[model samples]
Target chain A: MAAIRPGALDPARPLAAVPPGDPGDPGLAESVARCLNDFFTARRGAADPTDPRFDGEVVARLERFTLLGGKRIRPTFAWWGWRAGGGPGSGPGAAAALRAVSALELIQSCALIQDDVMDGSPTRRGQPALHREYAEAHRSGSLRGSPRRYGESVAVLAGDLALAWADDMLDDALDGTDRRARVRAPWRAMRTEMIAGQFLDLHAQAQADVSEPTALRVARLKTAAYSVERPLEFGAALAGAGSGAVAALRSYGSDVGTAYQLRDDLLGVYGDPAATGKPIGDDIREGKPTLLLAIGLRRARERGDPAAADTLRGAVGDPGLTDADVRAVGALLDDLAARSAVEAHMRALLDSGLAHLAGAPFAATARDALTALAGHAVARLR
Target chain B: MAAIRPGALDPARPLAAVPPGDPGDPGLAESVARCLNDFFTARRGAADPTDPRFDGEVVARLERFTLLGGKRIRPTFAWWGWRAGGGPGSGPGAAAALRAVSALELIQSCALIQDDVMDGSPTRRGQPALHREYAEAHRSGSLRGSPRRYGESVAVLAGDLALAWADDMLDDALDGTDRRARVRAPWRAMRTEMIAGQFLDLHAQAQADVSEPTALRVARLKTAAYSVERPLEFGAALAGAGSGAVAALRSYGSDVGTAYQLRDDLLGVYGDPAATGKPIGDDIREGKPTLLLAIGLRRARERGDPAAADTLRGAVGDPGLTDADVRAVGALLDDLAARSAVEAHMRALLDSGLAHLAGAPFAATARDALTALAGHAVARLR
Candidate 1:
């Protein structure tokens, strides 16, 4: 295993960039942000203004959700990966790479909209979720009938539009001869894994007979693929990295992706509402069938607590569960060692991922950026 | 305009390669059908076996509703366009083209699934629409919970999955060096236009002030871009067509696509329920402000019939409107010469589209195929 050391800075800081907010980094981030804004603007321009289907509200919602705030981790990964693979950061190729990276943001938007709908979450990025907003808009007497249905329909459409736009942006970015084929494989894989992962996730939740092993498999497929490995591989592929480099990045990515998901599971149950932008214990209310839940179930059974099992089943989908109940459940999870098991898994994953990256043929600066990214991926818990 | 001639076969048939119920055409048709089936199967394989999210009923519903029973015009356009652009029909390139064409079918599926949700249509392809099926499944006590919501959610996820798969399938098919760039442009255009057009359609419906001219523009952008012109251009692009050829195909495609959409509008309002697999007067019930509606509104206003205008608006969204009332509205539409105007526009479009094709440097066979396609584009009305 790689001997990884914690960075000097607190890993829990949300943004990847430091507090001084590197003047140089922001410029690149701004460029990417500008590219994203321009891309959406041009997209809206392509629509017929007279069509009632082209809801400005829909576009506005997407823009606000997508453009507002998130760590531009994927784009940064792409940039760092390019530099690592001996590609320069300032040329026509670089611009194309950045444009391709912009696609990550669009993909993220697509995922979030669908995720919001799937999770039935009421808010996103400190605002009402798209579906909730639409539903509320219906209540305001602007639209006629079935706000819930309208919200869902519009959200679905917006998501579909974003997904299509992502492809278009990627195609436009890779229009050049040099990077076209090289970018295709990773681009395709990133999309496939996302969809496959989502399928696994939805499947795991819906199945009554889900086991602990099955839940872990679901997490690996759903969260791991798009979250880390694919993003890293996508960046590496853009740099024309060979199979060996790509494979190493994949290993690193998979480990980090798994760790990231495991941490997300932890946060889902125990994280503060203010930090997570979700209600405390929302996952438990939704019966998320998460890794923590699986572990807790196992532990509860091992302790011969039939009442605990019943309590869990009742609490899983109970929207009325209170903060006190949430705390109690959190304590039970901790007592059951579910939290520690996940943390241990995350640690092992981090070690394996960093170890793979240590021997990768990356420049020192690139290596540091990646290592920083890995630290950031797991920094929330620490 | 190109010369019009009478022949043993109806010129109105969209493609001359195969007639309705001909066995020889079934080979290619069957290949397409099988390809589509296999595509869905391969995709479904990725789903978890135990998850009710992959419920047999939903899969069966999707297979029954989305997978089967399309004219496969887009794929045919794609395949024929490639052949016309100098790609052989039997080589690896041709096979790849076929796969790409199959991807179009999947895209169409994505579009239709969402379109049903948008329009709230209760049936598709002679069966209960996906959402309706889910609703029914819930009502029948087979699946518990909000079936309507379940249907919509599943459909949205299915559409998302299908859209992602379309990209995957396209990538798999276009795994070649020579035609990658050539194929990418039109492929990207098709995707962008469809989404943009959908937005325009939605936007147009919300604003009561949408004019006839603007409605036509929306039709051109949304329908024409995806249906005829873009599909042909996509296929031609893969075969390395020059600018002139591409431009000619675009012009032809634009006209044909518009005419096709116009015909569909007519069918939506007046076609037999059995034939269209839509309830009679669906367009009226949904208040779809289609081109036909625009023409009818214009004519109604021109005739100084304020009462007719009021009646039109009042009757549009009335789900409980009687069959007689629907027929009466249909008659009023015809009395205002809306149908005639649409037919005139269709004829003009067909003429203009064929004229554009006439000047292109296409093989005689391909040109003939296009001519047949144009004839078919307007055939149903007569």
Candidate 2:
């Protein structure tokens, strides 16, 4: 498949082109780009011609999605974690370690593809999401079958394939150790936690009685583990970082991960649709049982407004809901202070995560990178 | 879900449990059992509580199928390949390597699950196949969707999950190696080849001009790469086997894999329904573009008996095909010498595989295992 060069909207610019401090300094951004390129090239080579294995549409979506310009926070986290744990910035081993970080980005892509399908999302990074793209392809007679189901099935298979590729990439990343069991622990944990968390998220959506605490718990397990703890700890573990360092990184990761999801909850409601690349009031339309939603429900129940309860319940997932209805629901959410509560939660989590990072044995550069990641993960209303 | 134990099938007498080096080698049997238990126990633990994962069905089937038995050729091949490449049998690494071999069983299960779904097969191992079982479940309940589609979807998901897990297991196996790139090469190649082969098979079936040679090529690429060459080479690679050893093993694996599929083709036509756990003439009913089918078509064309061709085409995949139609098709297949030709192919492959194994560095005991596997793969008539 031909590569989809990132358009002007690509996230790679901010993340992939960070300026080096000096000629003598290692260009981390360049390293990340090279690592990503190599990983993707390997993946393409892995495509067997005998299999009607490659769907051009799916491939285009993945290339576009993966190449989207965001700060390579996860990969940077992995790199920094390794560096902090006494791994050097050069040599074959270090290069492999960095490639391992690149693998995390691919895994992230897999997650987003499946998550978009499950959420019935329409847009990603200012473009129609994978399923939407495939659906359009079907509409245009570019492919045949039940478009919606085809989109879902293809996305599912693509995600599965990507997930497998990530492991293969990681297998190419670890070097110079007999610590196979120890190194495998975090990868295994990451996969297990992510899947478990996804199930919890699904279950929470299905059940009507989800509480704030329950929702938060799901977020921590599902989002936090993969987004922060596992990636950091996996890199750290691979570098033979001691248990103490791993424990500290875990604490830091968990806090940042929780805050990350809380910020996402806030964005799901009030963030600008243009910037977020999703429809305004999408979460409400989808009836996502987020922290904000739980908060709104609790407040409405306390006020004993049965009418408010009916309105909220009826409006959730009602795609035909009027803009006025959307505004009204947004007003109710704000009035209930749900948005403020989420902001406060985010602040607490950021503070806790940063505090945990204090006194860790990581290099100053890595510490800075982690702080930058936390800041970006919860960046304000934009 | 509660553990679904295998029904009364004695593990010791399983179809594939040909004990080597004295049937009285209780120690070896104990070691094998211990290895199997530890392998599965760890696999079960690998499931995360958060993911609504595949309900341990892969592991469950692995346990049931491996325990119910056929000749344990693949695992033995893997173990011997490792040992022949200079890996010692006493260390923790050895155990890990053995566990890796056991994972091939899961991969095989995955292949079988997907193949059965593709074939629209109703039974496996004297019971309703997974898809059929799920379909039956939906029928017996007040399910709210298309039961067949749901069954297919679930089975597809299950197979996908198993495939993902297989890579995960292999990744775990290759951890802490400096030869990460080398170790991962075969895995990456295997995945690509298998998926490509599947596509080729599908494409061949859909086309009217598929030939015997083309169909055979598809089988070899799709089934052979993973089943024989990849598994053996993956183990050998991990044990630091030289390129020569890897090449030799590949040659051996290719021949054996081709023979294995040839035997499968024969069984699909002529095997007893009770023994095969499928309805008689399943391949005929499915219109599988097998080598046998292609040959039969050619023979019928030469004889100018368009009636046989018409009957064969009409009956293939026709759910309403009668016993008489099945008999006619079977007779036609035999008249074309399809059965005998396939049997000859199997014999040639076995001979070639064993010949390739000759003068290799494998242990005498391991060589015996390989020979046994070759025999067992083609032992149906016996």
Candidate 3:
């Protein structure tokens, strides 16, 4: 949490990246990875044999999924957030901060696993999703019953365990800190908000919502606040950030987070599978009721192109969609300029978020790192 | 947690009830209800409109499910365990103690919601289960997509929230206490054990497991300890119970807990729907791979009753099983003496559990209350 002083990270430099290997950020990422490695190693060995409840396979699967390469965006953002609150950038206290921030990854694991199951996603991070892996095992004759159901049950339990274990990990970070309640307050809020947001997203899909506001709200709740804002708050709270700083982070984080989700929505429609680790048009097939679809639909009908609108509608949620069908839908959206419209929207939001950091009382390194993170959040093609 | 003492609730008493309206237990129940009522009321008001994330329906559904009639067995046992550790039976401290104990209900709520969804259970407590209610809503036109999928998604989020919220509630109980870590140690263990047990049970079903030891292991994980033993530990820890007291309570609780599940499995087959608030032969319909079924199958084969064993197997896990099918299986099981055999096993477990409590270091009134609870656990029709 930092004061939202009016000025930009460089009002002239619109989300420009500094190439790869940014100095401190890479170390931050490495620290989080190391923390996760240790956590999993400890867990893998701690499986009790006397207690049949401690299944070896569950531990292995969980470890595999956790290490399957996420961008570690949350922890990166949290590190800067803590630094913004005057936490140590490196040295003795940094490990504890890093450990605390890594918890977001565990929580993310929970969300991703459950979300994949809910979406019926076949793959994640370019590999079979957790449920699909389990289903495959069942199909391989290792188990009975409906393979799909067994797979899903396993996924659900795995996700629940991740959430519980996330708290346990956070406990390690907060131990003897005398700030457990303070730190836990935001962490608890973040958990509830994420779940609620997920429910909303599901409800929107269920009701086939087309309202842009509703979709934006869903994105903000499910992605923006949960992915960006809350992680920032968690780190801030961990640093005992003051109310002023917390409010600044709230405004700056939400705006940037909104930009992040807007970019994600675009990626769902246009990003390459290799880069995104998801199939093109999968969201369309799932009828996600995302902002992109909402904008495309509304704009097409507004232009008196009923047939174009029809073509877009035809591909919105067609599970049987062919590659050709997806391209045609993509072409129509391109024709409507909907993609650029969203891109412009995202750019403006990101710029506005960066503008808030002007004159803020942050260490120079934190400011530079946050600026870099802002670039990644907004401009990353992946 | 309590030490495993060697005495009985009274082996010769035959589960004799102490009449209706037992003195202190009803008050304990009321106190828990009051805590839950307040928690829900606050949650209901906190649903912010600006955030589409929070849904009125979600909160209402969770509240309805939580309050809809559970035996509150865990909280009661926990309270006694606490009393056995010198926690007050009544007064101001009782409220805080009760709050901690009642968190178990929230955990139970999570387990029930997810379990129902996983089992595709149509009803719970003689009412439509959570997923069923949501699916029915979809069928009635308020939502779209696969009704079952939407319903399950909602139930999963609901359950996840219950767990997260349970921790939040526990935080309130442990607020400002120096003993937070001490109490949390057992709470964490209980949480992990119960989840592992659920997974084990699910795994058993998928494997079509028949080993009696494996079945018992699953029960111990899934039901006995979660429902009885850990709750006692939670209460004892809250009361600062010594290791000896904790160990004694653990023994008394687990044995009684084991009997509780054994009786439950029998009731699933033979208990009246009116009394149990569940349909008869439900376990068979769901293919739960219960201990009773394992015993029946093994005994039928051993007794040169392959035909009876076949008949029982035919009924096992038949989702479309008819009343006639259930009756035929029941008859075969009766012929194989599996039902009586399980009843005998349950009685033996109960007697042994009561035996442990005889020398437990509990106050006289706590002893009386626990004795009554033990009777209720094993012999109650429901």
Worst 10 residues of 3 chain A by lDDT: A10-19
**Candidate 3, A1-382: lDDT as tens digits:** 2332232222222221222333444455566778988988876655564263455657667767877557777787777788887787666577788898898888888899999999999988788999998899888976768999989988998888888888888888778886677677678767887888888888887787757888788888877788788888888888888877776777778888988888777877777666666788887887776777788899988999999888877776678887677777877887898887888888887788887777677767677667666666555432
TM-score per model (chain B) = 0.88, 0.82, 0.91
Off by over 4 Å in 3: A1-26, A50-54, A380-382, B1-26, B49-53, B380-382
Tens-digit lDDT string for candidate 1 (A186-205): 67666656655565554444
In model 2 chain B, which range of ten residues has the least summed lDDT? B1-10
Q: TM-score of model 1 relative to the true fold?
A: 0.86
Model 2, B1-382: lDDT tens digits are: 1121232122223323442442223333345445556655666665624332333433454455444434444565666567656666657777677666666665665566666766567777777777786666556764533567556555554555566667665655555544455566676666656555554554444443347887688768866776677878877887898877778888888898888777777776776666666566766665556777777777778888899777666765566777677777788878777667767777888889989879777766556656665666676442
TM-scores of all candidate predictions against the true structure: 0.86, 0.79, 0.93
Output the lDDT of residue B323, model 3: 67
Once superposed on the true structure, which residue ranges of model 1 sit more than 4 Å away at CA? A1-12, A18-31, A38-61, A77-96, A132-141, A208-211, A358-363, A380-382, B1-31, B34-67, B79-96, B132-145, B208-211, B302-307, B322-324, B355-363
Q: Is candidate 2 or candidate 3 better by DockQ?
A: 3
Ranking by DockQ: 3, 1, 2
Question: Chain A structural similarity (TM-score) per candidate?
Answer: 0.90, 0.85, 0.91
